[model samples]
Target chain A: SQTIHQWPATLVQPVGSPLSLECTVEGTSNPNLYWYRQAAGRGLQLLFYSVGIGQISSEVPQNLSASRPQDRQFILSSKKLLLSDSGFYLCAWGGPDYGYTFGSGTRLTVV
Target chain B: QKEVEQDPGPLSVPEGAIVSLNCTYSNSAFQYFMWYRQYSRKGPELLMYTYSSGNKEDGRFTAQVDKSSKYISLFIRDSQPSDSATYLCAMSVYAGGTSYGKLTFGQGTILTVHP
Candidate 1:
């Protein structure tokens, strides 16, 4: 079985602080990884996706960036956080099929 | 216009009643359609997936898609309180090149099933 892990489960940071959120996948190799932000009603918005190591495609331009350091490890980072950057961050791995398997998610609160 | 459109309903329904959710899309290139359920403050979970235009059924859920109409639906039978959550519709083009497995999601519909 394949599983995705994301952390710090929840975070509260002051505005302008640096941010790092990590996601990893187990039981699969060379899997497609994606980062999404879930707002209250806007649904899941794709932020970044990687097909392989060192390759990242951004869907929306924002204060965040993504990196794939290892085959199964993806990190979402920001040099400085903005108040609008607060939301539920989800990490997902694409399956052999069409759909995706998502992690528990990270609730980031930038105050 | 948005690529995908879904009613953000805080729909209230009694237990055992049938629940129907729907979404419309403006893009005709979408070949893979999916429905996901999300609990409060949690990540969305895949509930149903369909290819092109057709109907697929699981234990208690059914998914329908109409390519010509560019519409998709998810129906939950014998709704339970546990089913109370937000339902989101997502679609993607075929895997390859830049569009590989990238999904476009709707605004999601919130459903509350009461016991």
Candidate 2:
């Protein structure tokens, strides 16, 4: 079985502070990884997706960026946080057969 | 028009009643359909998935896809309080290139099952 781990279930950051959220998947290799953000009332929006290591695609332009440093490790980072950056961030891994397996998610609040 | 549209229903239903959640899409290229359930402050879990059209049943949950209408549905029989959550509909294309495995999700519908 595969499992995804996301750290810092809840985070509060000061405005203009740096942000880093990490997600790692175990028991799978070369899986497609995705980053999504869900705002209040709005649907889950795709932020970034990676097909392989060092390959990332941005779905929406924003302050956040994603990186696939390792095959099973994905990281979402921002040099400076904005008030609008606050939302529920989700990490997911999937394949061609089974659908995506999402992590517990990181709730970010920029104050 | 939105690629995928779902009613954001804060629907309330009694226990043991049948629950129906639906989503409609404007994209006809979608070949893979899925339904996800999310609890409060939790990640969405893939509850059911169907390829193309027709009906697929697993235990108490039934997933229906009508490609002609570009609509998909999820039916929960004998609903319980635990089943109260937000349901999201997602779909993707079958092409092996960039579009493959990329899912576009609906806004999600909230359902509350009272005990």
Candidate 3:
């Protein structure tokens, strides 16, 4: 079985602060990874996706970025956070069946 | 219009009642369909997945896909309060090139089953 772990379950940062969220998948290799954000009462919005190491695709232009340093490790980062960056951030891995296994998510609050 | 459309309903139903959720898509190449259940303030969980056109049943939940009509549906039988959550419909073309597993999701419908 495969499991995903994301850290700092909840984060509170001031505007212009740096942000980093990590996601690692156990028991899977070369999987498709994705970063998504959900605003209150809104649907999940795709932010970035990576097919392999050093390959990232941005779905929307924003102040956020994503990277896959390792095959099973994905990281979402921001040099300077903005108020609009606050939301529920989710990291997901695409399985062999093409089903997505999502992490518990990181709630970012920029105050 | 959005590539996919779903009713954002805060639908309420009693226990043991049947629940139905639906989505429509404009992409004709979508061959994979999925339904995800999300608890409040939590990540979405995979509830059911279907390929092409057909109906697949898993215990109390059934997923139906109509490729011709570009529609998909999820039915929950014997609904429970635990089943109360938002249901999202996602679709994708096959895995290849830039389209591989790049899912486009619907707005999601909120379902609440009362005990």
Candidate 4:
């Protein structure tokens, strides 16, 4: 079975602080990985997606960036956080059948 | 206008009642439609998906897509409290180059089925 993992599960960070959120997949190879942000009523917005290592496609232009260091490991980062950057962050892996399998998500509160 | 539009209903229904959730889209190129169920503070789960137009059913969930009207719907039969969650409507084209299989989502409708 394939599973996606994301952490820290929850975080409280101060403004201008650096941020790092990690996501990983198991039981699949060369799968498509994506970063999404879900706000209260805006639904899920695509942030970044990667087809392979070092191949990152950004969907939204903001303070956040993404990297694929390893085949199954994707990292979302920011040098300086903004108040608007607070939301639920989700990681997903795609397949032809089910569309996407999402991680539990990371709730980041920027104060 | 937003490519996809869904009524963000904080809908409350009694157990065993039928629930209907819906979304509309402006993109005629969109070929795949999906429904996802999301619990509070958790990620959304894929409930059902249909290609192009027509209906697909699984268990108590039925998904309908009308490409001509640019509308799609999700129907929950014998709705239970366990079925209470936010339902999101998503769609995508057949391919998107490097961004293939990406989905565009509606604002989502929140549902609560009480006893």
Candidate 4, residue A11: lDDT: 100
For model 2, residues A8-101, the per-residue Cα lDDT tens digits are 8999999999999999999988889999999976679989999899999999899999999999999999999999999999999995456888
Error of 3 at B70 (Å): 1.0
| Best-to-worst ranking by DockQ | 4, 2, 1, 3
Task: Put down candidate 3 lDDT per residue, B27-114, tens digits, no spaces.
Answer: 9988889999999878899999998999999999999999999999999999999999999999877766644477888999999998
Q: Could you say which candidate leads in DockQ?
A: 4
lDDT (Cα, tens digit) per residue for candidate 1, span A23-108: 99999999899999987678889999998999999998899999999999999999999999999999998842557889999999
Tens digit of lDDT per residue, candidate 3, span A6-76? 88799999999999999999998888899999998888898999988999999999999999999999999
For model 4 the local lDDT of residue A98 reads: 50
lDDT of candidate 2 at residue A101, scale 0 to 100: 89
TM-score of chain A of each: 0.96, 0.96, 0.96, 0.96
Q: What value does the lDDT take at residue A36 in candidate 2?
A: 92
Between candidates 2 and 3, the one scoring higher on lDDT is 2
Model 2 CA deviation exceeding 4 Å by range? B97-99
lDDT of 2 at B71: 90
lDDT of each: 0.92, 0.92, 0.91, 0.92
Docking class of 1: medium
Estimate TM-scores for all models. Answer: 0.97, 0.97, 0.96, 0.97
In model 4, which regions exceed 4 Å deviation? A95-98, B96-99
Pairs in steric clash, model 4: none
